[model samples]
Target chain A: MDFSSVFLNAALAAVSPANLLFCFLGTIVGIVIGALPGFTSTMGVALFIPFTYSMHPATGLIFLVSIYCSSTYGGSISAILINTPGTPSAVITTIDGYEMTKNGEGGRALAMAVFSSLVGGIVSALALLLIAPPLARLVLLFGPVEIFYLALFGLSVIVGFSKGSLIKGLISGVAGLLLATVGVDGISGVYRYTFDNVSLFEGIPIVPMVIGLFSTCQVFVLGEQKRTTIVHDIATFSDSSVPRMSDIKAHWFNMLRSSVIGTIVGIIPAAGMSIACAIAYNEAKRVSKHPEKFGNGSVEGVIASEAANNGVTGGSLVPLLTLGVPGNTVSAIFLGGLLIHGLRPGLQLFTKYADVSYTLLVGLFIANVMMFVVGLFAAKQVVKVTKASTDLLAPIIMLLCVVGSYAIRNNLFDVGVMLVFGIVGYLMKRWGYSTPSMILGLILGPMAEGEFRRALMLSRGNWSYFCSRPVSIILLVLIVITLVGPALRNRRIMSK
Target chain B: MTKYLDEYLPIAFLYALSAYFWWDVEDFTADSLMYPRALVGVLLVLTTLLLVFTLMKKMRLPQSKDENSPFKFCVVLAASIVYVFAVPFLGFAVSSLLYAPATALLLGYKRKGMVFFVSILTVVLIYIGFRTVLKVPLPTVTLLGMTL
Candidate 1:
């Protein structure tokens, strides 16, 4: 591969006017979505995807890249200002950020958060640039069985994400795979789950399911939560809102270490921003000299959470671009975007679509820098999203879902599918099933099925072919460990 | 309004769905049926496991215990269904103009003035974005000689 030319082309694409403007717009919107209590970064990307259908492929992707990176920063502003974390990843930031606001050091805390987010994002972006191309090169070596088990390995980790019961999560995941099998089978002309509907010939549209699960489900859940204001008091940004040199000097190690931790956690599929921040926060508390002050206006605490969450921004994209495995919900949406633009993830992406890939990578770093600048100036205004009325918000979200789904193929059936999935998603959440598992299943199921069938055909229906390959064997081992690891841990705890 | 999908109801639903899915694939060829049958079979076994876990009551499968008014959810859901139907007939602009406020009302928004204003604005913006900017072939129905 001509690495120099790829980097040069990417540099040009990233600086293109369309990429810059969309990147700016995506960052602002991402921030607002993150700052709102009910809205999320995944929802931001999913909802905005419709609006970006007309955009240039590189422009649209870079736009989403900005949104994915900046939304993590957006959550911390609300966490510091209103004591309510806008996103789950920002929950840890609230402990010290809120206390800092109470002590009139909100400015210092906010400054540190923005700085840490910037640092974390930059580090992970570097990781993505260096690691993704090599990973993609390795994926070129995979055969059908290896690819199939790799997806299974990805899906197996959802058990780790299970809130309560692993069986329930697997059930959700398997159901998603079933749903993905709807529409015409790609390899064969057979229609599996379409139920004789012409509208479903292409299968359930990804955009509709995305809008349903991430946007409409949130609308339904928030609709039931009743309208509530996130900002009560402490509703202003500090005048200076600038980090002190002393504080920066003190917490550089925490920021750097948390960034690395977040990046690594993020690269592991399904270990999302929330876990990254949680791990980083726990580690910060463990190593702090005055550990007791950790939750009480500790700058290290805010730095740890914000840095780790932002670190996930770049790291999540790595697997999505290189391996076609979404590290989290937002990256899942990103995969949908790339596919829509006719850019498949994996080997050919880094080679054939190097310009777009590099643009997204560089644009991500730019979004983080932009997030820091925007966070400095507009953090207070961003927190005002919590004040938006749910009455108005819910209907608007439904409207977006409908229009967004329809805009994909200009079909109304996608709109209907979105609504159905939304209601079903609401039910699933209320019933305590994990939605992410189901979503992952839906996204990965078809690929797994295709690979499984192809491998069988290659081996003339011999099942041993899967185990014969070393890579597939390794993946099978990974699946077993992913499934049984938690159970063994639970047993150990019980024995203790 | 089915408030809670109790253990038996969920199990029954899964059993019926899996049965239908299995029956549904009987017409397909052996190769075509492989994936679908495998999925349905898995679904059936999982549902059976769920039933066992539910009966045991110790494995503790999830139980829906939403306190939110199921009646309200039904109303909003019904409204959404109608709204989706309306779009093909009324077109994006008109249907959204009607659906947004109705949903707000169903979901307990009493501020009719603000709701209506926001609803109209949202509709107009969505129309421009989808029908105009994005150039989606949104329906321009003139049914009953009423242009929308």
Candidate 2:
């Protein structure tokens, strides 16, 4: 809550001309990531990390923050113009946005998207700066048992809600957790699954694995599409500026409520932007006087969808920066960035690295403004990325995947790992398995194992100790809700 | 060509991999192997269930007939494998220069001249970005009298 020092330091760091330039560049790249179909924010961040290898930590992180924010906004451009969501968060945006586009309100739709995203971004960033410290303090009270259950909750949430069979998704997640154990066992110094390969001793490399899953697999998917055209036209409305103030004032309640929903969902590990947008859109439709107007060019739907998507940008960072755990796939990549810079995400971030942390917070606000400005001016130009040939895009992305895999640790073996995973990823996609759940399983497996072991050791192998603690009990209940709630909902739908 | 085996294809791969994974971790001590063993065991069982679910569904409903070619996918994938393996000996510059065009052609890009030009430019930019700017050593290989 102490603001004087953070304000001065953050001002100095974020306002610097070089940092501003990098932040601007990151926003542009993020917009591209968001505008391009199948180019996820996670993949973009992973691809860019190797480029930041030799830069200042503050500069690198601020740049990444810009990318994270603008990309969320960028997804709307494609969603509105092309009926294809550039990111999963924008999937809801497509319903109203494309409807509006078809109805010739495309300009107003894009404009509303930009305005709502700005409001959501600022609100979430403010929440991140003010609320994270207290949350971090609460997190400090958590025992190993609490953290272990939290990890379990994080791992199961995505699997439980996957598009196809929940059991099948859980299987994919289990496979990832198994892959996470492929290195030397930390407790006993025993080689677990290495099979005498020296590269396996350090564990399966996450960077290459993610690139394989998100980037290379996307390349394969693009090729499968054989798309000769992304969209025939953007509609004449896109050539103009944003929506009017009356339009903004009309939907103010939806924007504010969805921002709140987005922030809350973002703070919960693995609850993701898709959930945020869905809940927000559902809430908006329920509360609207013209509820039937939804799915047919409803401006309220656009506001709810875009605001929540952008709010997720700020909300996700809360759990990540304070708890040293990722809230989503993008934050998991951000965690990799933080670790790469030797800046751990918990208490040390707010105390020892407060200067860098505040700088990132302020930089995110600046990034939002930049996104709105860029979106207003360049919507016509940037939206055309969809028209880029799949043949060209796929090869270039695959090239980056190869180089990204090789660049990490300078290991060619990692390139092989990435290729194998790419094939596996493509097959998984074809099979409708949940990739993010697997990634979460891989990211959280070691943490879950280590914390569970520590909790048991502290209790002298008393299995009842975890259930006795309030935090652990609450977290266990949440995990139960995460798993059982979905199954029950599915059953209800089936019975109907 | 007559009938697609796409439904069983994924399950077949999963069964094979999980079987290998099950056999792979058999040698570790119980404490060390506990988590991985559980995961792989669950994967094995769940994959079996997935197979059963697919069969049951097919029995009740018509299976989707996939006419999409795996030709482009397999060719690009094989090219990537070659490019990755070749990079160690050929250097990133040479291998990627060769790889880019090959993949583009395999993907049915009709313009050969543009592909050739883009491939060269791509290699140069990558070399500068990774090798020169980032100072990462991208496996310099010696051919004839020159180190590249």
Candidate 3:
């Protein structure tokens, strides 16, 4: 409850050289993993968690936080240079960034990403410092009913992300919900779908499932295509003119607005950088005078998406540190790291472990600085990797995917799951289903179920409790609109 | 591959699957029965509806259809099944190395040497990284002293 000691401790811990070194290591590794296509910041953090188990809790947390921040920026490097995104978060970045590269402005785009990421990250860090405590205090008012509704609100996002036919997305989502039901039924202490496997008792491991779905699946799909290497001939920083001060001045407002939008979206549980970037891009386009220029190398689009995605790094940390709830996969692994060190998150973290929290915040700031420098210096080399032939890249990515999945608890079953999902994912792709919605469902299904069950239990089976609360009602309405509004609009247009 | 999944053959297959699972899980109680059974039931119903829709469209206007490559699909499906079965027994390194080259050749890889080299490297790197860095204690059946 005392604030003075916590702040003092945090400030001291943050300034420590050892913590700084760990932060540096995390940032470097995060950047490398994020720069490589088929690997994500989430996967990087998960793979890196085992290595941090032996360290002090503060050091371990700092390392993880640094990785979380840096890897987000790293994703844009690939998206900008190559048409392929290093992570899902960078998907929006590819639209304008790749176009910029095609227009022979690769170096400037890379520079813009680095600078905007730093600005966005720093802004979010400041917001985290200013807003987290007060917001956390407000969150403390939440009962099981509120938490349940919040979880539902998070899970309902799957409908929003569904592409093509909503039916297929619904099927995929239900499949994920079914998968989440496997292992022990938490409330009843009964096994639901374990089928007698000992490993199923603990449930499908999050790390492996995530790695399998995203990485392993990617490998199998890529392997199916004949390997064709692409060699890019983009100009380097020296060859390509550095972005002018006028350019930075012109885009400063766009960067700020996108960062704010991105951070807010990131704070919403389960809304990852992909959505943040997309939302930011849409908002920027909506407000821009020359919206038509967006997909054709618009600097506004690049600024909006790049800043927004990076801003997610700090915004995501708010829930994790405050509620012991992860907003996304990377934060989930970081939460695991904290638990391994015998540190209980939530209110205690802010008060008792304030020093550690401050240290993490400082580490994030340091990581962003490092990301900017590294991205600027190594933009040329990063671009060259994009040009590498698909044949060579595909096999290498396949190897990384296997290793990444295996690294998560060393389970061969997870590897198999990954391959199986990969094939399924490929088929789904060919069949016109959205992989993003499926992933969202897989991530949020269990949370939604647990909350729904708990809310029902607390309310003694009162179904109206969800609508009684203003926030929950609003979220429910939004979910409905997101799901049905699109369909109605499309139908109206078709009828005309 | 070009044919929509909403068709007669796939619909019939789903019906068969639903029936088989329904039988396979006859002994389980209501709690156990609810989730997967509901899922399978939905699959059957949806596929059946899709099939009906396709049939209705066909009735409206019959047209010539291209010959579907069911054989190629069966081959790929069979290969996947074999790959999963082979992985554990042959070891990840061995099975994956073979799997990549075999798949490449099947997908029509002309550069044999490049494919072979890439496959070998893929297996070696995965083995080293997983074993050394992540410390995955994968089984190595070195009866012939082929150390990985």
Candidate 4:
């Protein structure tokens, strides 16, 4: 456990005036952005990244991590208050959260989100301490082919996320794959799609693409909606709105189950908060005595979603710090942040950067603790953000999107990409298609295609290679379940 | 003013766009085929499937009732293309400064004061952040013959 080092360094980093203050500011800003329906912790990390380019690596890493942790919880505020998720991870929160808000129990919902987020964070941090080292040993077995397949597996989440239409998800995934092909082919050195532009040599930048998909598209949707104002009225809350001990006692099992679900999902590369929240919410509802209460402001529902989503932050880091494989988009950025600071994530990261690493783990733990305090104190104000009209915020957010997109590479072509995706997203949203699926496809499709093709070549065009390896077989089985399990359940419910 | 054109036209355009890309893939062989071919293939396949699905189900997709589709969609797409082409000539800062306000106006913002203030301020903020703070390169389009 490196108890001595973890304790000494964590203590040092946790209490430092500058470090502590940065953590506080990051959380506050993170919660604000997360409370806004269109902004996400992913966007928060992306937008704030340029700012981090100036700070020391450790300080910068701390700031970004703090934002990532807090923003996951912050999303529930909007979900509870306005029935719109500020982040995809909080989508499940809206099912029950908004119901509670309508019944004038928004404060309690918010409190539960905070408490659960904290519990999830703390539990996962301890797990991080116990589990990360062994995982690092396992990661050493990964070669380029294995890494490629892993990336592919991560991207396949699009299949599950693609609304009712796997075709649309496939389209989005293929589109992302094609874009990933831009620039000189990494292996062949052949220029596949650069069209004579020098900038295309490096391939389309991930920062630009991500910003385009999440932020710019967000702007377009907001602008089109042209909402002017949002209603912010909720019956005043007394101190009792803070989750009571009995309330916590009542949901302890739900909390544990949800946190475990969140951690497991979070550990998988590319399966981010949205997946965790969805899984946790479903499980919570499944075992609930009042299952029907799930979508109607059930406190268990709020706990399940929030805890599971934020739990991803800790679970995600396990793979990242141990394996250098990012667990989700935000973790990918965190990897970049680590690299920009002259740190490489692999096994040596533990031995060489142990103090810094432990400090981050501890900081993550503290960030969750702080999330509870800040969230509880600011729950009222946070709800007001949700109440703000999407129409008004959309344009400004669009502006911010433009700024963020352009800021990444100072390229307008990237901005154009954002607008393109935005329109596509709007259309998909209107059609009841799953944007998450498309995003998953877009994010993971190329990785899967590239790796699957490469793995084939390495094995002399053998398809059974994936099945032969125990881990690969297990993962493939899990992937199949992830894809088919939901449909089976949905069908069962419908038939009933 | 009351026409079905607004309803069916966009879908038809998408259908056409998908078809065009689908056909365009034949221009290159596998080695020559870039990622766009796969993307276009997926897009065409999905759009066609969606089209069929919607038709079979008698589903009518949602469209804005404001009769603003053709113009807004066209303008938005055009603005994006123009921004890309203008970048090397106008440089990022000046182009963005000009583009933000202009695009806002096109999106239906009417107040001159708001437009001008937003345009100028947005440009300045971006300039300070991208140029000054982050030190990201903001090239000026010197070839455009516009000095400022």
Which numbered prediction scores highest in DockQ against the true structure? Answer: 1
**TM-score of chain A, every prediction, order shown:** 0.95, 0.91, 0.77, 0.78
Q: Give lDDT tens digits, candidate 2, residues A286-326.
A: 99999998999998999999999888888999988887656
Rank order by lDDT, top first? 1, 2, 4, 3
What digit string (tens of lDDT, one per residue) describes model 1 on residues A1-496? 5888788878888888877888888889888888887567877888888777777788888888788778888889889988888888899999999888887788888899999999999999999999999999879789999999878877777645557677777778888888887888787788776778998888778878878877888777666643333455645644468777898899999999999999998898877888899999999999999899987888899999999999998898888888887788778777778877888889788888787788788888888888888887888767776776675677778888888888878887888888888977886776667777787788788898999899989999998998997888888998898787877787788799
Model 2, runs deviating above 4 Å = A1-3, A102-105, A242-246, A249-254, A282-300, B1-30, B48-67, B142-148
Two-way DockQ contest, 3 vs 4, winner: 4
lDDT of 4 at A352: 69
In model 1, the clashing pairs are none
| Model 4 lDDT, residue A310, Cα | 81
- In model 2, which residue pairs have backbone atoms overlapping below 3 Å? none
Which has the better TM-score: candidate 1, or candidate 2? Answer: 1
lDDT for model 4 comes to 0.67
Give the runs in model 3 whose Cα sits over 4 Å from its true position. A1-106, A137-139, A230-237, A240-254, A268-305, A316-361, A434-482, A485-496, B6-136, B141-147
lDDT of 1 by residue, B15-36 (tens): 8777777787744668777877
Q: Which candidate would rank higher by TM-score, 1 or 3?
A: 1
lDDT of 4 by residue, B31-130 (tens): 4353455566667666677567656764444444332344544555566557656766777666666666676667666666766776677667766766
TM-score of 3: 0.74
Error of 1 at A138 (Å): 1.1
- Candidate 3 residues A97-215, lDDT tens each? 88888887877788888888888898888777776776666556666656655544444444444455555555555556556666776666666556788777766655555545555
CA shift of A100, model 1, Å: 0.4
> Which 10-residue span in candidate 3 chain A carries the lowest summed lDDT?
A230-239
